[model samples]
Target chain A: MMQRPPTIKDLARALNISVSTVSRALRNATDINPETRQAVLKLAKEMEYEPNFIAQSLVKKQTHIIGVVVPSIDSNYFSEALSGMTDCAIEQNYHLMICQSNENEVLENKSIRKLLSCNIDGLLISVSLQTKSDNVIKEAQKKHVPVVMFDRIIPGADCTKVIVNEYEGALKAVEHLIKKGCKRIAHIGGPKDLSVSENRKKGYLDALAKHKIPVREELIAHCKSFEEDAIGAIRKVMNAKPRPDAIFFINDLSAITAIEYIRRKGLRIPEDIKIVGFNNDKVSNVVEPALTTVMQPGYEVGKLALGVLIDEIESKSTERQLFELRTTLVTRKSSR
Target chain B: MMQRPPTIKDLARALNISVSTVSRALRNATDINPETRQAVLKLAKEMEYEPNFIAQSLVKKQTHIIGVVVPSIDSNYFSEALSGMTDCAIEQNYHLMICQSNENEVLENKSIRKLLSCNIDGLLISVSLQTKSDNVIKEAQKKHVPVVMFDRIIPGADCTKVIVNEYEGALKAVEHLIKKGCKRIAHIGGPKDLSVSENRKKGYLDALAKHKIPVREELIAHCKSFEEDAIGAIRKVMNAKPRPDAIFFINDLSAITAIEYIRRKGLRIPEDIKIVGFNNDKVSNVVEPALTTVMQPGYEVGKLALGVLIDEIESKSTERQLFELRTTLVTRKSSR
Candidate 1:
């Protein structure tokens, strides 16, 4: 026979006390006598009592669980963000329910619906690249669930958002390459629909304008945020009439693959063509001729997003805010 | 005003149908008339009815939610394992609530208690490095919740466990280095309390013994699974008398740090010191002179562990089983 854990009522019956007294003493309420509280604590420990969060949630109408939806957890960026979120959630006595969309919009919507059905008090989301509409966000709002968006967010959603300054980060990356005396620089961007991709591309173009460099339409390629697509995009940029002397990739994963491709073609980094990437992932440091990239504060963004979401959920605040964190250029062997 | 999502009762009253009929039609029961089913579906969609999983859990006594606890989500190994686990859980119509212990035993216990209170149907755990007792597992079992341990599992837990053949994987790693003519090989191990650390150490010793190599106490270092400690450990080993000509790191993170340390010392890889690591992390490939390591099938382990766990959960099986998955040696530039 399976043994059920001891409950407050069981403790009260065993100790010849009222259930309310047992609960108050176990909670260490000041109104309870010190002796009673101490006895309750000792008995609870002896009986191995575990707190019933579900019952507490029922009374409070708050589960203390936040649902997080991300494109994927396999990447360093997402994992690091999750780590920071976990740290903050634990500190606030909250737990997280995580779901991965695998970069599919349909999966993202399904994840949102599942989380809502599970009675999550709040949500933290990084929308998939293929997400086209804000209907899901509106649905969540209609249900009175507060949401905090991070990294990649819906363009017009009225919610709290935490993001890195992608435009400035991209501009810094390009300016660094231009300062290295590399002309005819090329750009490899991400899916056009994503705000991150669009902002980074704008930075790339504005940086070229600042340097009075001609915009070579042939030197630009947009990819669908996959390694295979990145490979094809790099090849296309390299095969241009006046092949680019340098390249700025939207992310480190793509930049790392491009580095390998360049190496296969017997091209030396910074000497043949310099490279710069976004999201200074750990791979950037480990790769041969370590990559120079923009460091996105993924961990900080996650922490701040959760903090804001909790504030909104608890306080029922309807004021929407946007937070843009800073990004910095990290120089390494690849761009030297 | 916040609007509550429409429920089955709302649909029944609006459609002038019996509540049971409405429920059956909404579920697409075979006995339900086709016209009624289509009408129910259309009304449910128009009313934006979201099923209440919490209420359903109360009635069914099954949450259809699995709780997962890991040491940390920042590492490639844990994230990949989580990916595979998520794939299986979603296929089984289960959602996962995830928590990271951050290698803290207290956090692991807290997470378990919280999950239990949430009434999760089952649990998947990789015990923290600091966990020394099985009280938490016993606690779950007493509550009639099934648990499946994977990767870094507790010894003698009387539960289902999925693990790689660590001893064999380590033995193979050391043997590969020895076969490459490395007469003096060192080891960087993990926390002493962990079963993984103990098993791998045994493998390293047996491999050296099989090769007729003398055991040198000064050449072995046990680290706390961090890059700084790994750096300190590598320095200690490298500074020893008759310094090691090869190193077998317990994991890839440690090995990657060792590679950087060796380079800083101006020693050439494979020529001066061959390196082999356990767990073929993505960083292993990105590192200069890509590392040769043992590939622990983390994804497969996660998938199989969850599969076994669901079977046990559904069947109420009491049989305890241990699954040992195969690990293969991946030779790369560092050990060539």
Candidate 2:
């Protein structure tokens, strides 16, 4: 049999005090006298009493539980963001509950409802590619629960959004490739439903337009953001007439796919096909010849998202704040 | 104002039934008549009334929340394991609250205590290298909460343990190098406290003994089970007399570090030096020469751990079961 810790009632009885007084003393409530609070603390310490958090939340009306919803946790970028969030939460004595939707809209909604049922204090989300409904998110706002968006965000949503400057990152990547003497450039776009994909595509097009390099309609291909979809999309781009001298991919996963395809064709990186990718993931550094990509501050985004959400949750105001993070280009052998 | 869903009290008032009956009917309890249950379900569906999980847990004594404590979630192995656990949990309509101790014993104990305060139904833990207290684990057991250990496990504990055959995987990795005509091989060891690391080291020694190759004390180096530590240990082995023909690393992180060191020294892989690693992480494929590794079924360990935990939680009389998963080697360009 396990030895259990003492509860508030047990402490109250041991100290010859009422349960309410014990609770107020534990909470350090202003109504409780300082001498009584000190006495209660000493007894609680001797008893090694750990408050029942669930029972305490019932009266305080706050669980201090934050819900984090993400597309996947396997990627280094997402994991880094989560690490930052957890670090800050630990320092603040808060807890984070993670939910992964696997990029499914239905699953994402289900997770939101579950978080709501748990009475989470706030929510942090990176919208899934398949997410289309704002009903659940709006419902959270109505209940005075703050929502903060990060990475893949929902445009125009009435919530604070933390994001990287995709347009500038793309421009830097394309500029680096052009400086490396690439004339014809191609682009591998991400999933159509995501705002990041559209933003990156716009950045690509603007870079070409700014350089007076005519955009070729046949040079752009919309690939599903993951690994399996990348193979088919890259194959099509490789087979195109006047094959691209350089390519800018929306993400590292698809960028590495293009590199693998180029390698299979006996072509060398930079010498035959220069490439640049967004999200300087671990794969970017591990790949043969390495990869030139844009580095987003995942940890910063995470910390900011939590800080912003916590502020909103406490304020309960409808005002939304949008945070745009700056990104930098990391030059490597792939685009040299 | 936010739209409020009908509560059990509201349903009882409208249907002329007691609040207790309404609550039971909402939960589909057998004690409530089938007609009453159907009526409650019909009304709930029409009115969009979602049951409050906290309120329900208060009465049923089941929170439907599972606590997961891991050393780190950023690694490919742990991430894959978590993915499998999350998939299984979602299928069962259960939610997971994950916490990482980041390899600190104090943090691990704190996380466990916090989870217990939340009244989680069960716990799934992968003990960190710094974890040394069986008392901390026993505390959860005393509360009648089931715990299932995965990957890094403790011995002689009265609980279910799920693990991969680490010794067998290490043996295969060593045998591959021997078959490739490696007469002198080196083994990089992980942290001393972990059971998996000790088992793997033992397997490497056994393989050498069986092959009639005299075990050389100078060929072994121990590192903290992390990439940085492995790099330092590998450097020491490289500087030794009669340099090893091949090095067998404990995991992919260390293997990748060794590869980087070799490249920096301008030595060719498999020609000047041969390398093998365990845990076929995604980095294995991206690295130059494509790392040859033993693949542990991390996802299977996670699924099995959760399944065993749920089984034990549901049945009070069930005996503790140990699950050992099989591992296999994947030959790639590095060892070929």
Candidate 3:
């Protein structure tokens, strides 16, 4: 291991003081007592603690912090993205202040305000499904805080963004199903407002058209959310005038639900109804016949978002950048 | 919808200024321009903004924030728990500042120090598997920051802890395997130093003793981490003197891995060798033959931990509390 430099954290531990206290002493603030300040100074001198060493601690630069807000951390997608964010932040010696929106727009805006009050250097956010306003982004911009959006984002917002290629992923899935001799393919899509949903649905439509298969409006089912709505969507498609030979779901959980529901109806996978899902989650493979899904690369999306945010923060650039990562199809037993 | 009260965020947006600037103006700080302060004061008066309404905004009080550190959010268990923590914290009008340790002790300590520097009111942490010291908690205490541990914890630490009864979960799993008429049972355990590991191992042993099965030390195999070591542990136990009739795993992921491995070895589950795992994760039911495992209420654990931390923070009692939750076994096809 490399020898670490002396910093405010080490001084706080040695002096039995809070890191903020050590910071106050270093800044020669009015609130600190003379004796405490003297002890901190003496200790810093003895230990060769450098105030100019910016990467050592948050206090070294007053703040080397980035604020992040997400819809939820409990979801595998967001959590994996969060892990990637953490890796990049720690590598660059910046700390993260995270807030979860729980898919509520009000909470998302409230979280942004809280982070702004904390004087965050930059902001990173993944918009919640309920988010309908870009007013919060404008407010952040007016405050001179650079902003970056990831995954579930505002379509018209002027900011750096990192997202997986939803359209391509969906197109590939549809093409693979067609190759597997699926003639009448149906889709289970997400809420219409989300870009991911719209893009994927478009891909599904275009792929069907390319294969000389006419789009049947009844074959397309949209769920309000990723809850029991998935089951409702499945029932709607399975009970269609012409039942689909293949089903493509918006996510792995929904696809897994469909698999079980179809099986309970005494249908064999691939033999009765082939299946494909997006976001190659761990459960995609753990399921009985295993799922053929598109890998969203959540971790890469997060890492790239953080890197872009840091670039935007340091460059002071008004020009926005958009990055789209390609998703690969992972074929499994269900699709075959 | 209930009429929402205007707060400093509204004041900031109305004035087209940063939230920090609005906060400074509200405090009558010397740094803000006089005209801006006057504008803010007028807006607050017109909108009936209440500075004393503790729940309205972060500016109302200096801080209503709790710092949280976890090993990794990408895992379903922690993510579900985080969702619970978020629910409780938001309900109680507190924001969360989150940091991920990524299962590194150095990073865990660094994260705790960063949270302390933010001057958080209290802390809720689930220690990383690598965490071995209580020194950081002491440092947090020195700053009057109350902390509560959840999930993976530092045993014997003088603080509130909310954890599932690991011993009970493990015993239930092992007993279920025995009930399936397994004669020679084997176990794939966790790392040696974790209290969770020791408690679970004890449960496995005691369950066998209660069943009057002779102790076979060779049937036990320990893995260092939750990664590929699980496969090695499976190989170790499966190659024992008399290949065990049943395998009890510490967690569901490992048990699934064993299921696949045993099937590849041409062993039929429940017919040749039964299996039981701990933690009824979502994937448990998705897997082939569905895993028989113990249900760990991660979300409940998180909600309870946050509530307890808030109580400790507000009550300011020196007495620490410990909360142990019970686990229920979910019987599935794998063990039957």
Among the numbered candidates, top TM-score falls to 2
Candidate 2 per-residue C-alpha lDDT over B1-336 given as tens digits, one digit per residue, 9 for 90 to 100:
325556778788778889889888976578989998888878777766777666667667678888999988777788778878877877777777888889898989988988888888899999888776677778888787888888877777778889888898898889889999998889998888667778899889988988988888778988975555576789988876888888898887678778868767787798888999888877577556778999988777777788778777778644778889989999898887
Q: What is the C-alpha lDDT profile of model 3 across B172-205, one tens digit per residue?
A: 8888878778889998998886887889999999
lDDT of 2 at B68: 91
Q: Docking category for candidate 3?
A: acceptable
Off by over 4 Å in 1: A1-3, A6-52, A55-61, A176-195, A211-249, A253-276, A283-291, A331-336, B11-50, B175-194, B211-225, B228-247, B253-275, B286-288, B333-336
Q: Would you estimate the TM-scores of all the predictions?
A: 0.82, 0.88, 0.75
Q: Please report the TM-score between candidate 3 and the true structure.
A: 0.75
In the order shown, the candidates' Cα RMSDs to the true structure are 4.7, 3.6, 8.1
Model 2: colliding residue pairs: none
Order by TM-score, highest first: 2, 1, 3
Shift in Å, residue B95, candidate 3: 3.4
Error of 2 at B14 (Å): 1.6
Per-chain TM-score of chain B, candidate 2? 0.89
DockQ of each candidate's interface versus the true one? Answer: 0.40, 0.40, 0.27
Residue B287, candidate 3: C-alpha displacement in angstroms: 4.0
